[model samples]
Target: MLKRLLCLILLCAALPAAAWDNRGHRLTGELAHDRLQASDPAAVQAIVAIMARHPDKARFDRNLAGLTGEARTRRLFGLMARWPDDVRDTPADRPDWHYALKIVHGWTALDWYTAGKAEAQWAANLATARNAAAPPAQRAVALCWLLHIGGDMHQPLHRGHRLDGSWLKSDRAGTIAWVRRGPGLPPMELHQLWDKVFDPTGVDGGDENGDVTRLHAAFAPRAAAMVPDGGFVQWRDESEILARDSAYTGPALRATKAPAEAPPMTAAYMTMLRTIAERRVIAAGVRMGAALQGLR
Candidate 1:
């Protein structure tokens, strides 16, 4: 029994990180879009029209091809919800808009401001989401960030950067924060692994929107558990805590040790990480709904 338990632990600890990935973004988008659909159809319509004119509308439409009716509409909203991340190369991209801080163990807004980073762009982007006074096109752009950043900020890595000695070396929020749980697994980014978690396995073949629906269903309970009263700051604080507790600590430290040694993965550890990933995604979706409705 002891040996079997040890083996299970090894398998679990080896699981990858999750964040900044498209599928996770899409789930948050779809979940937020669903909330808006129920509470503010007009906001939904306005967003749909704006997405129609997205700088990369051609690609969005291509993704929409071959769908119809409610499915088309749901998929459209899901796509719109995630559209901002897809336009990184276009002029529409706002690099700072995606993250608020390179957080430390006990970071404050002052620390972020001192580092010359905005407290949170999503807060300001809300103006565009709320501004009926602004042109529809402009508001649509801000709305994308509002939706996109809600999910982005929930990513533990996004709220904080890993420190190396006295200097910050977060590897671009873990784009380069590599890890190796054991010998058999390939080296992977801490951020990339988190982003890859919660992906829908055995999804309805190629019908990605169906996968979106399925994902929302899977995460709905996690979203319910969030019950947030504040906004980005609340979420950011939670993510920052998770970063310290899970992302930067644990097997990660030993995984990259000088002796090239580390602890093994365990099922218990894997469950804890999954819980964090699912909860963050769901919380982002729920808060996004409130943010969208509040704008309207």
Candidate 2:
């Protein structure tokens, strides 16, 4: 039964979705690593030791085995932060782990909540993770979820798809809104653009083992100050509303239910989108950094 369940989840992985590209996840992990370490050094050490058993052990070592002193520690913590996404491709991974059901607005719980939701799992996993007596492997898995899914929940789209009686389906959290990069530039999915674009317009940080320089938390000062003292539900509450935000709004966006035309993504709109995307990335980092209280 467990193997069958894992197979089902693996099929769901065919759908495309990424809350924050590697860089964004890395940034969030770094901030959270620092936040937890500064106040609870031992907690950070304990988590990292377990993560050393991450299913992808060889990759973890080859990529994160450089630097010295605090630099090495931060980088490992940052990489472990992204470990969950890697799990998405593994058989035992949770296909729905990257997102939660919309928990805001009128959707208060009555007893119908699914344990599979990222909101539920991250919080529950925190408790599992804090229990050092649990199997080391179980604790390691929980740590990855707390880091990766915790960050993903902060991404507004991942809060949940919005479908009012219409077919827009919240444009699949902006994925259906095909955006033209410039007047004649190659177009891409609006959601993907948000995932890929950078602050100040064109800061290109290669996503690789050596990409830590640009992924540093110091690069985003405003985000560092925006960390909130909250948990999974609060993070979802904050991000779920952004579906209606201007970045995801437009005539083309509204018609995405069935057959629809691509949106005319304007330069001004692109600039505004960049701004909102940057802030969201920063906020994810800040909140994810401070979100480790229970697990720590």
Each prediction's Cα lDDT score?
0.62, 0.61
lDDT, model 1: 0.62
Give candidate 2 regions above 4 Å deviation.
1-16, 101-116, 160-170, 199-212, 215-220, 251-261, 294-296
Q: lDDT tens digits, residues 1-296, model 2?
A: 43234323323333334677777777777777777676577777777778766666777788666677777777776776677776565786776767754422222231123223676778778787788788887887777777788777767667644333342123445566565555554556666666666432322344454454664634556654564666666667676666546544553354332223444566777677667666766676666666565453
The residue-level lDDT of candidate 1 at 206 comes to 55
Write down the TM-score for model 2.
0.77
Output the TM-score of candidate 1: 0.78
For candidate 2, the clash count comes to 1
Report the error of model 2 at residue 91, Å.
Answer: 0.5
